[model samples]
Target: MYDQLVNLISTLGFPIAVSIYSLVSLSTKLDELIKSVQEVKEDISAVIKYQKEK
Candidate 1:
């Protein structure tokens, strides 16, 4: 019974750790993507404003 408990804890622990790591990595990537998108939006707005002056 003790061996089974240890095995279960070890197995569950790895996946939970991996899941948390993945979530953190994904969150970081999403923040970078959002910043890039915002930069693109600003660039497009600038272009539009310049064209209107013509």
Candidate 2:
């Protein structure tokens, strides 16, 4: 019983930790991607406005 309990804890712990870490990392990366996309949108709008003026 003790060995089974230990084996169960070990098996469950690492994957859960890795899954949580991956989610946090993905959230950070997604935020960066969103910011970059917003910047690109602004740049495109500026170019369009400039072309219209010319």
Off by over 4 Å in 2: 1-12
lDDT by residue (1-54, candidate 1, tens digit) is 668646755878867756866898999999999999999999999999999999
User: What lDDT would each prediction earn against the true structure?
Assistant: 0.85, 0.85
TM-score of every model?
Answer: 0.73, 0.74
What tens-digit string does per-residue lDDT give for candidate 2 at 1-54? 668646755888867756866898999999999999999999999999999999
Model 2 residue pairs with clashes: none
Model 2 TM-score, 2 decimals: 0.74
Residue-pair clashes per prediction, in order, are: 0, 0
